[model samples]
Target: MAINEKSPSPAPAIVESEPATRCGSNTPGLAATSSNNGEKPIAHASLEERAGALAVPPPSGTTSSRYRWLVHVQFFACCWAMVVAGWNDGSTGPLLPRIQEVYGVNYTIVSLVWVFACVGFLTGAIANMFLEPRFGFGKTIFIGACFQFVGYAIESAALPFPAFVLGYAINGVGMALQDAQANGYVSNLPNSSTKMSFLHAAYGLGALASPLAATQFAQLPHWSFHFLISFGVALLDAIILAAVFRFKTHDECLAAIGQVRHLDEPSEKNDDSGSETEKSHFRKVMTLKETHLMAVFILVYVGVEVTVGGWTVTYVINERNGGPSSGYISTGFFGGLTLGRMGLIWANNKIGERKALVIYAALAIGLELVVWLVHSLVGDAIAVSFVGFFLGPMYPIAMNVCGRIIPPSLLTGSIGWIAGLGQAGSALFPFITGAISNKAGIESLQPIVVAMMAFTIGLWICVPRDKVRTASPSSSSPEGAGAIPPPPRPVVNV
Candidate 1:
């Protein structure tokens, strides 16, 4: 096999000097370009193009059977770790009231946990650029494990308010690191939509279990003891990852999974080649229209999910006059979320991704409004659960769509930022809601959620469609690489 960049007219790389656009004008679903005669469907043309592109491929050796076993190990172990992270995510909101009671703090002060967690996650996401390039995948994940273990150890010690918040921040960084890596890695696999859905479902499953356990454990004299369970699980996950992936490096792992073909490895003497490769990837990733649109969409989606999870119990008990027994309703919301991710994988695929997203977003918005407008606690609880159910499939679906649109060369870094910074929703929106509640009342979660849902629908409309255009007659049998798709169109419907 041979490798060469010989497309007749390649799309120019986005220059570093230009800022990336915030949205694109392409149609809602797949990006497409009609055939010259306008007789063929864009999807069909895209598959043909992909086929031709695959025909003149770069050299790559087949993975041995050992690689297969390790791949399974890596996948299951990463999933185990994600489950622990999910447990942390779900338990927090339920335990927040207890923490506030223990520390004698108000809503505004208690919200700092989300803020600190946000900071930690963002820090870790940015740190990936330096960490993966130097330490590679296995060692880098090991570092994250250390951070989680140490952070959990601190939290389990039952420290002061500030100290406990600090522990959360540290653990946030660790979890973000792992989360970003796992999502990116999963997106490149062959059955990505299914895999991503299942991966996140595991997260949801763990999330479902967390609130149930936390509500039980949080009642006694020690609220923080609930975290000890999470700590033990995290420790076990760390050991699994370390044992399975000890020697694998960044390039090694991607190659093992077939994502390494898009970017070539530079020879030892040409250090500049590596730098140039990185720059080119950075250019495509930042410049892609889908990258920005998906980022903002996720920002809103995550904020909606975490905000509801984090503040629902507070809202139910305080604003709706529900009791501690009702606080466990947060798990119902999370249970819907888990089931949605698990159950909706087929529906999402059946309808195109864009339509599926729009449908779910609309459903979530309406249900959330019911939770807001209605005064009954039981009614609100049911609405919140349904809202979570609709909102469940959003994250993994968004990530899967993103992987399809962005060039393969930029997958890891591009996804790293998307998963990391997009997660700021986990902090920013919730913090804003908490602050507003401090002033106006906890009733504010309703409008914030409604507005976010509206924003989500509009943003999905602006996402670039995935399609392929026909080549001119002269280049009918292209010599080398397939042509790159055109740059993202202008913002259309948004």
Candidate 2:
């Protein structure tokens, strides 16, 4: 007998007032009665009732309304930490002359501070990969703050040359940890682009203000006293971090915020499996071509930024033949950088990040050229400020892109590596410039900056575009097949 070919009838839909499985217990026959049969349909259980039924806890990404205030406080603390980092970085440029005079060293020797800082940054990046998983975000950030406090304390006393360099290494570790965590946290939040811009703008504010303080200190006998100010800020950062975080682990913090992952069904895996998963994730992050491309792009970008900020005063004094007021050029550069980050959010959104960055780089290169070719001190200073303005938004924009491209699972580690390694450019390129300047004169600073800016444009082109997946109409339903839900966008109006 020939059988007719037909698809099987679809299964009847069942409406459950409460889940059949709760806390490993099976409680069947909870489906709502049919209203067509003259029976009342059952109401759905509330979230509290559902939680009580399921004894298992939710994952870190779940949202809890009660702990939302902590998120805002933590964000402010992160901004304050960035300010401290900027102060440390910005002070170096103005204080370079005084440091050289105090230690009786050349440009090459003075540049060792950058080298040591680079070492510290790399070390911190590596350490964060290991430390964050074990100690969690709160402790890691707090430890980093403590390291900065130590570094600043040592530097404030103006110790022997080797000890002074060691302070920078310590500071590097602190900054790297805080930088990685803060960026990772902010990038995941709602309106991340705007938030990232504001965060970096805080850094620019510190950078802008530092030169003003450092210039005056450079003329004083106790020039090293400038670090005392940094030391105080670092201490404040540590206290705020400790109090706000309450030494909570990463998972604990997530749970407190009701942002638990796998809210309905908890995983039964042990620590060993978790470690293995992390290892695999790390392997995946390292192998991706985007990670390396971003690392290099950031390295070159930071190199150009720090090189200009750190060397501009010296260049103005020696190359442009300016006097005590030359240090103000550094202030102008950071001021422009701050303004760009604050004011250019609209432009960044209008033109798109990739194209906007290309434009910004081109403009920056033209400004660098003007600074190089124009002999007028006033014109060079103004051009340098504009250069800062163009370069200012690049860091945050690149960071936002990095967040989008990289998997959320591997975000913290990947950012740690990228940010840590990228910061190396701040040290490596400046040191290279200083070593070269020892023989070639500070005039070479312009060529070096222009070359790096050109190179940044090329590297940025190689970065992968972020993948944007549109949800189908069916996928919008909770029960849709092959549906992947987007994360909640919780606005922290701080």
Candidate 3:
């Protein structure tokens, strides 16, 4: 946290000084600066240094390298949540027959339970919009674990269908909270998207583990025991979260970096006379364009990504000739997801985030097509796993883009809303897959997957490059304005 200031020059006439209120700014919204304006430019380099400060820089050690132990602890907690929640979702298909015989519930009644999680997800996503801002990501995670643990406990005890549904609802709330908070927290970290891939892969790892656990437990007299295991995992997460309360994640570091960067910049004393005018413009522009568009982008991104992950496995097994063991094919899908995530860590470190995403997207669509065209189970499984590799980076990259676009003042709410909407998309598409598969046959799932990928690439084209890079006057100075920026290189820690 060091700020080195150079001599300050006279403030140049306003060239394109877009004034944005700080995130959580009590001040009115930001005014937009048109690049077309003819004002004299400020010192480009100095302004950029200042703007970068305004950005929450990636945390130095609170979440990386030397703080390895803390990272391990948080990763474990995150993995635990993912596994249990995913297991609840994944295991149900296999456990359905057993569950029906034991409870005497009809198929339609049982289907209601599957959809219940989405209801919970929607509720939780909305709840997080309020909680994340007030409590911060870590605290929100702790609270989520509590809800998940208790909710699972209730379900594990074998309550009535209504009670079971209630428990699932509660757990869905917990899932949404953790998913949004944890994903946001990780993406904000320096080189976090890669870590994000790993963290999510851990969930897949957990899901992979679940089938074996469920199969073993299937021998037991009661399915309640399987749920008890989920409860135990959630409880363990709570404990781990408590132990790591003192540690900071990527968000903390970014916040600190932003503060330092902002502090070193020259003050607004020179423009105080015109501050009111600038502020007025800022408000109008924010309302008219940036805010709303950013929201839409976020909502769409999340929905698409989740829909892919949630349904890909089912598509592989049900349509492509995966077999009775096909339910286990979801594991292959998740396994590819895990490997893809691991690979992203390196890719993010070597290439820049934008390029990484673009490349991954290309790979994803190609692999998806491979799965779609090839009816052989072997080819389908291979393609599905590869799809994970490409799909690995999308969620985190979209989040990082959101962080860059939305100012910090409304970051938590904006991020939460985007995430919630995305999950809502996640829920929508998966539910559609289930419904469609019921009537059209599972093989029809390929077209939807392909369509979603095409849609994602189209949206990605709309992402403004300014959102990805620093917005200092120098970066956007007239001379440099239209130049295509070079690819970003990964920053290395010494």
Candidate 4:
């Protein structure tokens, strides 16, 4: 396979002497420019040019110190946003009983919150496809935050049941945008596997802490008080995003992280082509077999994760005859999830993402069985936590695989679809559980989770294997000055 001879022109008018590949290597073409020492030969170069010069393993050293600092700050903001998302998702489990009591609703009625949220998730996912290209990552995230703020505000008011469910819908839209962008952004960074783990670990931390707060808040007359805390956090998240991103466009954000490559050349001939191009990319993403498999995989995975977190409190209280502190079981689950993400980085690497997920799924199935069969409250609680622990790493690992296999051009939209649709499971399965529990006992939760886990293993097996790329040590390092080696032709087995 031969590399393309023509490098795509940058947004600006500057021309490159040598054609470069997506992996940041110069292919054999024309004479090399003498100014290849991470310095621009042309003054007033485009942001794409600057990014090209800095290259892929992510620029480090004195020259990019400020850019590095900005990346760090931006990551912090992303993590904070994830925490808020986790808090929102995790809060519902502990508050479910209280919400039912206040509204005088049954299991099926209370589950409407998640159903409405699922609708919001689908809406947000579709909106993201159009929004990011037009509004840029910064504004897109801020818009999501604003939507979340509105949702939290509505929920905190403790409105009618119908209105309360509407809030979850709005909140779902906000979370979909942030989740897609944050996961896509981190996966492109250096040491992505490690960073992606930590980024999601922050989400786990938020999920862990929220139950503790929500359980206490459930004791109050106004159970909606828990959302007030989320309202404040959402406000803070919006502010941080606005300040850090400064409303920069998508290309500008890519330039900041040294990932600008193969961006669509801005056409003076047809200004409207940008939207058309986005549509084309989206169409291509839809046609790919990998995209569908991944979407279903994530959908099932998230469904199981959220179902456990959201319904565990009700399960404990009703089945185990537990006290008011039953919410702690939810906290224990997310705590194990957070610990697994942070602690299992080495294990993931040791076992590989594809094989490791199967093992994790199997372990989670066994744990779910323990939670179902065991009558002891303490024993069920411990099993639930371990179930969360094994299930924790699956999401990040899936995201990492998607980043590797998907083309850079389609990455953002593909991820938006994957994350957004995947989140539907978060609502879809939970809603199903509740509706079913309305007829069957809440003990049905374990069987549904176990079935999803088994189905997830099948989905994982169907996903395409990542293309193998070999990088020289110098190119792999942040500080090494050697030219990056050209990537070999992609070889797809089966």
**TM match of model 4 to true structure:** 0.83
- Evaluated at residue 347, the lDDT of candidate 1 is 93
lDDT of 4 by residue, 142-227 (tens): 89999999999999999998999999999999999988778766765545678889999999999999999999999999789889
TM-score to native of every candidate shown: 0.78, 0.81, 0.67, 0.83
Ranking by lDDT: 4, 2, 1, 3
Model 3 per-residue lDDT tens digits across residues 12-69: 1111111222222211111111123553222223444333322222335443444445
lDDT over C-alpha atoms for residue 390 of model 1: 93
Full-model lDDT, candidate 3: 0.56
Better structure of 2 and 4 per TM-score = 4
The C-alpha RMSD in Å for every predicted model, in order, reads: 11.1, 10.6, 9.7, 8.8
Ranked by lDDT, the better of candidates 3 and 4 is 4
Task: List ranges where model 2 is wrong by over 4 Å.
Answer: 1-69, 254-278, 468-494
Superposition error at 136 for model 2 (Å) = 1.0
Please name the candidate that would achieve the greatest lDDT relative to the true structure: 4
**Minimal lDDT window, size 10, model 3:** 25-34
lDDT of 1 by residue, 384-467 (tens): 889889999988888877766655435566676777776677887888898899898898888887998899898888878753
